[model samples]
Target: MLKNVLKSVGEYKKETILSPVTVALEVLLEVLIPYFMAVLIDKGINTGDMTEIIKYGMLLVVLAMAALAFGALSGHYAAVASAGFAKNLRKRMFYKVQDFSFLNIDHFSTSSLVTRMTTDITNVQNAYQMIIRVAVRAPIMLIMAFFMAFKVNSELATIYLWVIPILGIALAFIMTHVHPIFVRVFKTYDKLNNVVQENVHGIRVVKSFVREDFEEQKFKKISSSIYKDFTKAEKMIAFNAPVMQICVYTCMILISWIGANLIVGGTMTAGELTSMFTYTMQILMSLMMLSMIFVMTIMSKASVERINEVLIEVPDIANPEKPVTEVANGSIDFDHVSFSYSQNPEKLCLKDIDLHIKSGETIGIIGGTGSAKSSLVQLIPRLYDITSGTLKVGGRDVRDYDLEVLRDAVSMVLQKNVLFSGTIKENLRWGNPNATEEELIHACQLAQADDFIQTFPDQYDTYIEQGGSNVSGGQKQRICIARALLKKPAILILDDSTSAVDTKTDAMIQKAFIDEIPDTTRLIIAQRISSVQNADRIVVMDNGRITDVGTHEELLASSKIYQEVYYSQVKGAADNE
Candidate 1:
């Protein structure tokens, strides 16, 4: 845990040390105040010197005011530094997540990462503050108070020093017990977060199914488990507080007992005995403050380790040592391509697939629910590398091309297209930032989105909520298509992107696309046969491999898989009519 804490600090070397140094000055004043109090009590009060009392009392006030000023300044700096560190850490983590290939993202879910960003980062900030604020102050006060006690009477201070080693042993025991509980507690917190996220996002589904009670029960089970784990960990560490307090109080009792004997024997004056008691109390109280920091450090160590896991993950697809890519036409060839997601099941997503798509031709990929259509498209853009075969984009192997170059040549409209919280023009501009008004209108026309967009209150200036939730499904799909069309790439992929639209709009969109982009190489993945019937070639896949390849008429005449899907869908459409 301590190692991880040091590592977390090591990453933010610039910001971490400055605040502590500023705070050290504030802590020095805290230590100085007690000595001033001692001087005022002994040098002024007992000796009956009015002039000395007023002078030292005024000095005490000045020191206290100075202490307050130091505290406010240091506190402002510390907060600024801590918040800036957290911001930098989160931004770095977010970029790291972006750089990490899909495999790393799959390993950590959306909710899990959210918990790491929000809850875990907060723990680190808290730990950082405690380490700066209390850790420095407590030890300095402890040392200064001890030295003062020994100056007044050496015997009483010795008794206080003896209890220190026992406090250290008790602390060691508490830390030993805290480590495991903290690990379990963090996991439990992630689980609880996931459950809450699911329940909230799918609250409508839960209500529709009338399973609110069921979902609530499930949440309660996880929540109760988290509650139990957290309480258990707190109690394990909480035992240290009472135990340390008892030891400190015992030392206090011993000091009062021993100091009185010295005073009676005329070895210690009354004022000297009083100063020793105050110093003993200061030492024990400082130890208690230090104990709180110890407890926080134990928990934060786990959080830092969790954060470090993300910071160090290197992406599989990074800059190549040497660059190589040259292609004019958009052509794709997959030779015996095979891939499986590294996670559970390990079922092959694409198996022994071989296909070629020519430039200036439209290819349709038709498949059932789990037939690897999306997986095949993902490989073309190299979102996930093909586990075992050769894939070439534009006559060159994709791996030979720089990642940016390959992605630039290809534009894909994913099935779940999300628009940011911005104006309609802003989302479209993401596809081609340099596009003029005429170019934007042309792309929107090709996408069959110009009609409805112009109907809106602000037209192009209309604001879209994040994920385009404010718009209808069909409108979002058309906008996504417009965004893709605006890119005007050498290769374009629409992965079941038109699923939400009515058949008429889908047909109109497809027609405009064919009219405007006839020479642009395209791959259309759709469930409906009518949508793909006009494609130059159609590929039919079953399970994970392509089972058929031909024109619409050729597939109806030849492949069993293709024939079955076509006739089933055609029959359903006719039955509905």
Candidate 2:
């Protein structure tokens, strides 16, 4: 996990290396200052030698200034390295997500991924900064200070050995108990993010239903759960400070009492005892810093695992070793194909579907809500691979084709029309970035969107809000259709995309498809029979199977499912009239 995460340290290695190097230099200078102070106090102050005091004082001043410079440099380098690491991590995770197949995305949900990239990465970044600076400084200071204290007097230095073990055992006890709570807390954070995202995205629906209180309750529940977990973990971590303080004071009192006796007995000097006191503080403070490092490491360990999960996740879909680059035609052949989102044979959403379509054919599909109408068309573009049998597009297996090449040849406007935050022309250009102005207008006209767009003051330059919130549902659908049409694909699948538009506009859009793009194979999925009634052939589906396939009039005569749907719409229309 550590190896995978550290791969993102790409160009920041220089700063990462420099941080520790500067910290080591700063620590060396710090260690020397205490030793020189002992010399100044002994030979200069005690013996009344002014020259000796001046020499050591000058050395101490230079050491202090140099240490300060290196300390500042370490901080700067640590910040740069950690911030750069986080940027690289987020960028890599985002690009990896872009390459994820639908199945991979389903495995790790949107909310979970968002938390990993933001909150989790931030935690790791902070841990990294501490690791290079404080983590390096603490251990080095502890070892060096202990060595100098032992050189001064071995008996007082032995006190640290006993205190170190006591602190270590206490820290270990706290960490082991707190780590599990932190893990649970982060998982709960994912739930909290999910709740906020859902409530924000559906705020209009929530408000229309007057369920603000209910939404608030939901948020509070998740928030409260996170609060409880964090509080529990922090309570355990809080024990660390008191434990460190007890150990620090115990060492100080023991050294002070023992040193005064040694001084009276003519064994230890005043200057030497003073230096031992300085070393004691340094040793104890380094251990305290290490305890803090331990706490941070425990917290970020869970985050590291979460981030590494994303980093190491192998995308389920990738181009074949030798991929077919060109689609021969719009002709598609599904030979006994079966599929399941979970890739489970027993849970298939599309089953034993044998269908063939020629290039430039117009086919209509009608089905109940869960009949997998959308699932069937989604397979053609390799959105999800089939579980069994062969799905051939342009006379080659879908897995054999380059993902980009196949998707470019087949444009699908899904049931939910999505528009980004941009001007109308910019959104339309998503289908073809280099589309000419005339091409954009022509595609819009074919989708029956040009007339409405021209009414806007800015026309094609009109800015759309995110999700096209500024536009009506029908307008959003028409604009999406125009965007899809801009692809000039060999195959176009409109999966109930025109449902929001009036039947008259839907008819005009279909008519334009036939007149303007005769060579493109079209598959239209619609609830209303009138939308597909004029197709060359209409397919009636039920429960993941094609129940019948025929022209509209033939299906009306023979297919019970088709006749039922047709008569119900006809009866509903007459009643409304």
Candidate 3:
């Protein structure tokens, strides 16, 4: 755990070193304050000469003021440095997760990844801050306190020999009992995040199905788990303050008893005894601070382990060694490609899939619900690595090109649509950052979005709510299509993108694509036969295998799979109309 955490922080070696250097400077000042108290007591109070007492007293004042200035300076530096480290860590983790292929993402849920990025990052943040300010100071103050007391009187320092070990034992017990709860607490957080995330995203489905009561109960189960685990950890740790206080009080009383006897014996002077008492108290306080740091360190260790899991996740799909730079032409071929989501590999998502798509051709992929239509398109973008076989994009192996270059050559409009909160223009600008107003309008016109967008008072400049909540399903799909069209990549994929639009609007949108995007190769996946009827070729799929392939007319005549799809969907559409 320590090795992994240090490794991530080590990525910013200069910043990591600067952080500790700054913090150590600040804590050095704080450590000196108690030392001045000893000096003031021993030099000024015990001495009879007013001149010597006044001189050292003024010097102590100067030291205190200087320490304060340095402390403030160190604190500012630490905050800036720690914040910069955390920002870099967040950026790296986000990019790494994005770089991960689909099969890798499948190993962790969306909610879990969110928790890793957010809660786990905060956990690391707290530790980073505390470690900078407190970690070294606690131990340094502890050692210095004992040395100061030993200088005043070795006998009095011996009292700590007994008390410190008992404090250690108590702290050890707290650490042991709290460690397991920390692990369980993260799991509870995962459950809570999953429930809340799903409920919020799928609120419409829950309401339509009238499952509000069921959803509430489901949330209760997860939330209750979080409450229970958090309480358990808190209860165990709460014992530390009172237990440490009792130990300190007991030591204080024992020291008073021994010191009183020494004072009566005239062996220990009044000023000497006073300084010893102050030093002992400083030692006790420093020990408390040290123990608290240890507990915090333990908590962060657990968090670090969780975060390190993600930080160390090696994407199965390696980035290209010497990547291709040129824009790939819209041509793809799968040479006996076989793949699965899992290493234990329960069931293959695609098996022995061999297909060729020529440049500028339109291919419609038809499949049953689990027939891997979306999965097949995912391969062209290299979202997942094939288990066995060669997959080529533009005559070169897909893995031979930089992922950015490969992705830039293709655009995929997913079945699950998402839109950021921004003006329509801003959201669409995501597709083409340098696009002009005219191009935006043309793309919107092609996606059949211009009409609805213009109905609003602001048109293209109109603001959209998060997730495009102000729009209907068809409207969102059109906007999503417009965004993809603005990119104008060599290959365009519409994965059930037209499902929300009526057949007539769907046909109109298809017409716009054919008219305007004449040179781009297209792949459209849909359950409706009409959506694909005009495609250059159609591939019918079932249960992860290609069952038939041909043009619309050829398939209706010869292929059983294509004929069944045509009969079911075309007949259904005709009856509806």
Candidate 4:
């Protein structure tokens, strides 16, 4: 986990190294101050030499200023290194998510990923700053201070050796017990974020159903879980401070008692006793800092594992070696293809099937909800790989071509129409970034979207709310269709994309496809029989299998499933009239 996380510290290596170097220098200067004060008190005051006092005091002032400079520099570098490391970590995770295939995304929830990038990264950042500064300073200060105390008088120095082990054992006990609780706490944080996200995104439906009370209850349950876990963990961590204070007081008293006896016996002077007291505080304070570092490291260990999970995950999809660069045409072939979202052969969503579509042909597909109509078309863009058999686009295996090149040649307007928060023109430009104004207007007209767009006060530049909530369902669908048309793909697919528009507009959109883009193959998946009656050929699917394929009239006479659907829709239309 440490190896994986350190990779994101790119370019900050200089600051990372410099922070500890300055901290060590600061510790060295601090250690020298106490020793110099011992010289000033013993040789200058006791022996009545004013020159010794003046010389050591000035030297002490210079050492203090240098220590201040080093401390400030270390703090500045630690801040820079930690914040930069966090920024790079977020950027790396987002780019990695972009590279993941649909299969990989299914393995992790949207809310879980958000929590890892945000709360988890912040914890790691705080811990890293502490590690570079306090973690470095503590040990160096402890060693240097202990060495000075022993040099002054070895008997008082032995006090620290006994007290250090007692403090160490107490800290180890606190750390081991609290770590598992922190792990549980962070996982609950993921659940809390997920609840908030779901409520916010589906607030409209929740309000319409009057489920605000229910949502509040659910949130409280998860939030309360986090509170309980945190309180328990903090209670365990709270043991640390009291234990540290007890050891500090015990060591100070022991050192004072021993030094007083030694001084009266004529072996130790008042100046040496004062220095021993100073070293005792420095050593104990350093031990306290180490305890704090250990506590932070335990908390951050959970965050580190969560972050490394994302950083180390291998993208499920990548371009093949020696990939084909071009797609010759829109012709597609599915040779005994089968697919399962779980990648398990026994639970395939699409059964072994064979279908071939020629360039420039208009094909209509009708099926029940689980018949895998959307699943079939999604394979063309390589959104998910087939589990078995060969799936080819432009007369070559889909896995053979570079993924970007293959996807660019195919445009699909899915069953769920999505529009981002931007001006109408900005969203349309997603299809073709460099599309001219005339081209944008032309594509909208073909999709039967130009009339409604013109009615908006800002026309093509009208602002769209997030998810296009400012527009009606039908208008959102039409705008999405226009965006796909702007791509001018070799193959155009409308997967129930016209369900919101009136029958007349749907017919007009279909007619525009025939009149304007004769050489581009079009695939229409719809539930309405009227939508597919004029196709060159229609496919009838049942239970993940294509039961029949023919022109509309041929299917009406020969395919039982087609006959049942066509009559039911016609009967519903008659009854409405």
Winner on TM-score between 2 and 4 is: 2
Q: Per-residue lDDT for 224-288 in model 1, tens only?
A: 88788788888878887787778877887887787788778888777676667677777888888
TM for every model, in the order presented, reads 0.94, 0.98, 0.92, 0.96
Model 1 weakest 10-residue run by lDDT: 1-10
Candidate 1, pairs of clashing residues: none
For model 3, the local distance difference test gives 0.81
Name the lDDT value of residue 87 in candidate 2: 98
Could you give candidate 2's per-residue lDDT for residues 1-577 as a string of tens digits?
Answer: 8988999999999999999999999998998888889889999999999999999989999999999999999999999999999999999999999999988988889999999999999999999999999999999999999889999999889999999888889899988999999889889999999999999989999999999999999999999999999988989999989999999899999999999999999999998999999999999999999999999999999999998998889988899999999999999899999999999999989999999999999999999999999999999999999999999988999999999999999999977979999999999999999999999999999999999999999999999999899999999999999999999899999999999999999999999999999999999999999999999999999999999999998999999999999999999999999
lDDT of each: 0.82, 0.94, 0.81, 0.91
Ranking by TM-score: 2, 4, 1, 3
Measured on C-alpha atoms, candidate 4 has an lDDT of: 0.91
Q: How far is candidate 1 from the true structure (C-alpha RMSD, Å)?
A: 2.4
Clashing pairs in 2: none
Native-structure RMSD, model 4: 1.9
| Colliding residue pairs in candidate 4 | none
User: Who wins the lDDT comparison?
Assistant: 2
Candidate 2 C-alpha RMSD relative to the actual structure: 1.1
C-alpha RMSD of candidate 3: 2.7
